[model samples]
Target chain A: MRVALFASCLVDLFRPNAGFATVSLLENAGCIVDVPPEQTCCGQPAYNNGDKDNARDIAKQVINEFSDYEYIIVPSSSCAGMMIKHYPQLFEDNAEWYKKATDFSAHCYDLVTFLHDILKITSVPVTYQGNITYHDSCSSLRETRVKDKTRHLLACNEKINLLELGNPEACCGFGGTFCVKYPEISESMVNDKIADIEATGADTVVSGDMGCLLNIAGRLKRLNKPIKVFHIAEVLAGMTGIAAIGDADDTKKSEPSS
Target chain B: MKSKSHAFKQQAADALVNVSLQKALLNAKDGFIVKRKKAMDELPEFERLRTKAIEIKEHTLSHLDQYLEYFEQQVIKSGGTVHWASTTTQAQQIIVELCKQANARTVTKGKSMVGEEAAINDALEAAGFEAIETDLGEYIIQLANEPPSHIIAPAIHKSKQEIADLFKDHHKKYNFNSKLETIPEIVNEAREVLREKFINADVGITGANFLVAETGSTLIVTNEGNGDLTATLPKTHIVISSIEKVVPTLEDTSVLLRLLARSATGQEITSYTTFFNGPKRNSDIDGPENFHVVLLDNGRSNMLQNENHEMLKCIHCGACLNHCPVYSAIGGHAYGWVYPGPMGSVLTPIMQGLDEAKDLPFASTFCGRCEEVCPLSIPLPKLLRQHRNHIHHDKLNTSRSRLGLALWAFVASRPALYRPLSNSFIRALGWLGKKSGRFSWLPFASAWTQSKDLPAPAAQSFMSAWTQQQAKKKSSENE
Candidate 1:
């Protein structure tokens, strides 16, 4: 299978390892992967901010960039969901573009969903021995229906222990501009999320979306927590040798679990 | 009834630090969410029923004018009068005039949200008619001289101890001087005071949960039976309902009622689901001698002309409010209006004009949980986004944020520029935060860094790393 990696702007700029792990995992699953550097964003910020004109321009740019790929897999469900669900909405007024948008959306899939549903690769040959909890991003869970597929992939890794987080579907308060716009409410919500994460006593937290991972990791770091945060792709590809998210250096051992 | 939606941010800040309010909110949250979930679980056909409810509401809204006319005709045939009001003030004036005509000195109310919308109690009081709240929650807030915070549970923000005090302070006027300690005692004390008011009041008023076009019957669902008493006890009963509340038939009302109580308080049904048509018949044992239905338009007719016509399908279930993360954090007072929560966030802006209530839409996380649990499937997040779009298109937001978004949009749309600029920016940030792996503070990120550290970006962009990997792979394959 020929696959194009849609490294969301967040993953491209902030967490490239997750993007690389995505490529590695896809290649190992017998797929040819390409990183289209022309791709910039999924236009969610503009679209969500109610800037339809700019959202349309950005959507057209993204659509044109990955239009030729047989499969467009995004590591971040937030970005993938935007492409799959909202791109068509942006072009409803323009029938010509709507056709192209729908056709393109059909080819788009979140990374884990692509691996499990389309590629039929549920389990990856990866190893991790510590207890980890999964935070289900709202877009991925509700929009893309990615709840059980991710757990199915993680469940295959016998070396890893998966702890259930409370109300995993709850928002992490990183609602694009929401965290910045209403800082107090966002702070309170994320604080509640941190308490739930702590209750599980999981050493690591994993999720499919970079936006949520960054938000949770940011809070965990500010609280000076020892918990490790990794994108699901990183663990699935056995790429935890580098520093976990929100950490400056790989000062700790490469494999803390074993 | 005056809008405090403009000061939402400040009110929300205060609510955040309020210890008593937080404790009360937590208790309400546990009770509402658990019961709702269990009730929904017990009904295997709940989703199917929700679909039917949505369809019924949609059909009714599409033909609202026809239904309203038919409903009016049926009410007239049943010897009741239907009065139309284009705005809230008009509705209030209509009710006050009717009260004056009936020579009413005191009017008892049954937890009417529309009454709150129209500021009827204040108007009636200003007009020299004592307006008494009959429902326990409404009565508590009325005595405290406050608006109903939550729609169904008006005093949800108050603690039990606070209610006990409120009763002890206010009930003394009714010769009830005993200090109420328990929940039952407080309820009984209020009931005793309200029973006399209900019996003596010349007029009674209530909000309709649904208006049956087929039978011209106004239906109200309540847990404490206050609405039923308010609808039938006095010499005259007036229903303040919006034009969209009219349904085609009683059967349609039943389908919606099945979801209403379960969604509102998680009961299979409320303690009272009463339907009364017009005034008392000759053979009737008990009912008001006079029946009146005030169909208030108040921008709903205008709302139907726009993309927001679907908003009229709401049954005022309050499920969206209970499930909303924003409402749960700040409580209803922060929304600063009669309506609060996800439903309030959409309705307040439309009803009060976007300029006055623009902040309400932006306060949510757009989590879509409200839509999931909504019985009518109101598409609350979509309506909220529409409000945001209106605000943005009209330039209602601050110029600073507007300019920032414009600049960001320009950069983001151009990949060639955005790639290099953002890539270099993050690389620089990564180097600066090398020690902490996160930044405690960053320019333009005070909102996030105020309470949380921002995760530092990687040293290289994914595009650059992928390029290097490709070159390395080509060389290895050639070798």
Candidate 2:
């Protein structure tokens, strides 16, 4: 299968590894991935921030870039969900563009969902022996319904225990650009998210969106916790030995014995 | 002065940390949401009506001016006085003048959000007239000296225990209440109390759900039939509603009405979809002697010219509030406005100002639940994002966010600049963070680090890694 990668703006700049992990998983599943150099943002920030003019231009750029691809796969569920779910409505009045936007949405997939549900490639053909907990991103859980697909693929890891965090689908306070805009409230929400993770008794926290993982992991780092974080794609890509971040590297990472 | 869209973090934190308020809100939030959902689920045609409802609202908004004129003529033709209120103060002035004209001492009200928007109750009381809210929910909120938190259930933030306490404390003032027990008992007590006020009321004030332009008829749906009593028996009947509530015909009104009840309280249809065309007919046995319709424009016409014209299509179902995670967590008080939830987030900024209500839009998780469930199908999140974009241009955003945007925009605008910039940034953070495999508390990102650790970035970006793998494959094939 020929797929185009819409590596979200966050993954392209803040955390590139998630973008790479997504590519690795897709390629190993026998799909040829194409990274369009002409790509830009999906205008979610512009749209979310209420700038229709700029959002329109940015959305047009996305449509023009990937309109020809048979299928588009994205690393982050939030960004992908925006295009698939919201793009058609963005161009509602313009018949030609609206049709094109809807057509594009019909073919886009979030990485984990694409791998487990769409491609049906369960195993990474590699093993990882560790206990893990999954942190469900709000948009992915609510919009794309990524939890089941993410869990199905994770279950293929015979030696891993995927313990669920309390309020698994709660927002981690990294609501796109929400963290910086309302830092105080963001802290409270992430604090609650971290508390839930701590209660889970799992040393590693896995999530689909790098934006959420980064925000939660940032807070945990400040608190000096022993918990670790990784993108679901990296784990599903047979790349578990290289802990993404927050794990004690040389000091021996310990999973919860229970 | 909650901004149209503020950051969810600040708002949620402020709401959660308010111990007494949070405890009060927890029960009320669950009660309304669960009840409304159960009501909505019982009707299979509920979803079908949502689409038709949107169609009717859209139709009304597009021809609002024409319909408003038509409605006014109909009301006047039907022997009812039609008054246009350009502002809230103007609307209150007209209503008070009507009260004085009739020499009215007591007024009974039936759940009007437009009244809250107008601040009408204060004006009536200032004029030495008593205005009693007949709705149980509104009565509770009136006693609490708080704004109605939710649209349908006005005092939805109050618990049964808090309510019992409130009545116990205040019941003696009204000369009642030996004992009040159970939800049903409290409900009965309120019914008994309000029933007396209904008969004695010289004038009745109620907000109409929709006004039929062709007939100049006022339509209000209530389960308890308080609206009927409020509109009848009294010598004067006055309706305070925004100009946007006019529909061209009764058929059009019916279409919207079907969805309004289902989405709001999950009822198939409110028990009383009462329509009052004018004052008592020649042979009518029981009807008001005087009928008045107050058409309030106040910022609605301005919204018509703006991009939010679609928002006027809202039937005021309050479904958005019940489904919103942000609203569920904080309740309506934190919104600091009359309107709350997804609709409030969009409307507050426009009615207030973009600068003042900047945090309102940021309150949502952008979960799309509001958009999905709205009877009018308003693109609430899209409108909210527009508010934020406006804030960005005015430089109203905080220094941290503006800085974050500038930094991201600079590198992200170009791949060549972005690639190397990302490489060093990721590697440096990833390397430094590897001790315990993560660094606690990153400087400059203290707000984020305060709650969670930054996941160390991978040593490499996806682009370079993919390219490297391809090169290795080529070399292996060549060898």
Candidate 3:
């Protein structure tokens, strides 16, 4: 299979490891990968912030950059969802561009969905051992329907123990620029996300999107939490020799399980 | 009086901006959203109910002609009258005619989004009938001469102080104390004033939460019992609702009710989930002598046929409103519609023209809580996108917004120009924003920079770094 890698802007700058791991995973599955040289932000930031013009402009750039790819895969479900569902709607007026957007949407798939649905990579050869909790990013879990696929991919590592985070689909307050714009409500929402993470009793938390990782990690850092936060790709990649962040103590969650 | 949509937006903006109103809206927002989420989270049958509700709406809408005919027949057979209103004008005309026919001097109304949709009170008064809104929220706003700020809550935007003031000015004829400032006090005052209208009025006008075609009944679920009073007290009971309110069966209505109140107020059920099958059946002595259910189609029949038809599944729980950040920021009034928050954003464009109501969709943060907590699971953001898509395609993006998008599209599509240009742009912007790591002002970007800071981008773009990472990852794997 000829695959095009859409390592989202966040993965490129803030968390390159998830992006790299995705390329390695896809290549291991016997696929030819192409990295389009001109990819940029998906414009979700400007788009949601009433800067539709900037959003659409960036969307056009994104569409034109990888419009010709046969199989476009991304480590993040949210970005992939932006391409899959939102792009076509964004360009619904300009028939020519709308067609390009739809075609791009067809080629685009979230990493787990691409692995599970397209490649049929149910389980991979991986090793890990710990109680792990998973946070389902809202756009992917609900928008792209990546919940079970993501879980299945994580469960591929037989040595891993997957603990279900309370309210896994609850938003983590990273609504693009919303955290900065409405800092008060955003803090309140992230506070709830942290509380859920604390309830899971997992030494590590894994999520698919880098946007969420940064948001949750920032919250964890602020609260000075000891639990490690890693991208799902990093978890699927696994650590060979050393323990991951926050591995020293398996702090038990105080609450009785419901 | 302002249009229902504008009145809501203006009042909501006032509430959202005020420290006290913001505090109250925040309280309401958190209380409703949290409880609704917990209730939804706990329900194993909730997803199934959502699907069932969708199925009910789909079936009801697809066979609307048939179900409506059956419903009309049943209403007539059960000693009631059924009126078909194709437009708001027709609806108003029929209602006015009913008031004339019955010589109704007063009308007691229940909270109704459809009534808001029709602007029926204005018409009722134009026809010389005094329409008294009986729902406490509606009554507060009715005295203030404003629209319902929230669906279900109706007067969700108003504080008790506003209600107290409204009562002091409007109901002085009864010598009601102006000092009442509590929810219970206001409710009592509204009840005391409206009780006479309910008793002495020759007719009642209420909106149906759901119309059960299977049983030929109108269903209204309210905590305040205003809907029940409005439907039963007067000699003539008139149920007015949009065509989409109809469902196929009582079982379907039950499925929706289980989700509605929980999604609405976190109640297992509303205090009064009344199903008035018909009026004055021989066994029913305490009911209205004449029962009339005026089913209004308005723009809904057209909306029912569109790709965005899924919105009609809204049970008016206001779960979407309570969870919406924009709705929280501006309150229901800013959306400038009868249905405020996420649900109203979708409906306003369709009912009103897109050009007139372009700002509603842009108000959302695309946070997705509305979809998550919705009992019927309506994808609100997606529908909002439809409104924007129309606005965008037609070049109706807001005056300043159009030029910005055009420039962005121009620059982004051509990276040879965009990369170096944006890099330089970022560099200049970084210096401009160095004082606080944020820009207080920037040409064309001031709107954003005003509310929030535009963080400086990394020295390199993601594309350049991804290329470097890719080569390194591949070689390391090969080694």
> Who wins the DockQ comparison?
1
DockQ versus reference, model 1:
0.74
Please list the residue runs of candidate 1 whose C-alpha ends up more than 4 Å from where it truly belongs after superposition: A252-258, B475-479
Scored by Cα lDDT, where does model 3 land?
A: 0.73
lDDT tens digits, residue span B1-479, model 3: 23444344344445544786566675676678677767877887887888887787777878888888888787787888889899888999999898888889998888888888888999999988888898888888888877776887777667778778888888888887668868888778878888888888888888888888867898888888888888888888888988777787888888888988888888888888888878887776798888888888767778778878888777788888877756766666666666678898888878777766766665555768788778778889878866866777787665665665556656656768766776565546534533432333457644333333333333344455556656888899999
lDDT for B451 (candidate 2): 53
| DockQ of candidate 2 (2 decimals) | 0.39
The CA root-mean-square deviation of candidate 2, after full C-alpha superposition on the true structure, stands at 4.7
Could you give candidate 2's fraction of true interface contacts?
0.53
The lowest-lDDT stretch of 10 consecutive residues in candidate 1 chain A is: A249-258
- For the candidates in turn, chain A alone yields TM-scores of 0.96, 0.91, 0.90
After superposition on all CA atoms, how large is the RMSD of candidate 3?
7.3
CAPRI grade, predicted model 3: incorrect
User: How much of the true A–B contact set does each candidate keep?
Assistant: 0.78, 0.53, 0.12
Q: Which stretches of candidate 3 lie over 4 Å from their true place?
A: A1-4, A9-34, A41-75, A86-137, A144-258, B1-15, B168-171, B178-183, B419-444, B465-479
| Number of the top TM-score candidate | 1
Question: Could you estimate the TM-score for every candidate?
Answer: 0.98, 0.85, 0.77
